[model samples]
Target: MVEYALMLAIIVGIGWLIYNQTQLSDKINSVFNNAGNLMNDAASKSAKPPTT
Candidate 1:
């Protein structure tokens, strides 16, 4: 009985870790996407020819 309980606890812990890591990965991806967009916008603006 105790062994079964221990196994269950380990499974739960692994599932929790996986869930948290997935959430963190999504947040990190969003941050990088935003940064890329900002960089692209800046590059586009700088590419325009200067006007008097």
Candidate 2:
């Protein structure tokens, strides 16, 4: 009985961790995408002809 209780606790803990990580992963992806967009914008501006 105790072993079953312990197993349940561990499973719940792992599931919670996975849920948190999924949320965190999405945030990380958005941040990386924003950084990539900023880099692309900078490159586009730099590639333009120099002003007089």
Task: For each candidate in the order shown, give its overall lDDT on alpha carbons.
Answer: 0.94, 0.95
Deviation from truth (RMSD, Å), model 1: 6.8
Candidate 2 local lDDT, 1-52, one digit each (tens): 9999999999999988987978977888999999999999999999999999
Q: Write the residue-wise lDDT of candidate 1 on 1-52 in tens digits.
A: 9999999999999988987978977888999999999999999999999998
In angstroms, how far off is 47's CA in candidate 2? 0.4
TM-score of 2: 0.58
- lDDT accuracy of residue 10 in candidate 2: 100
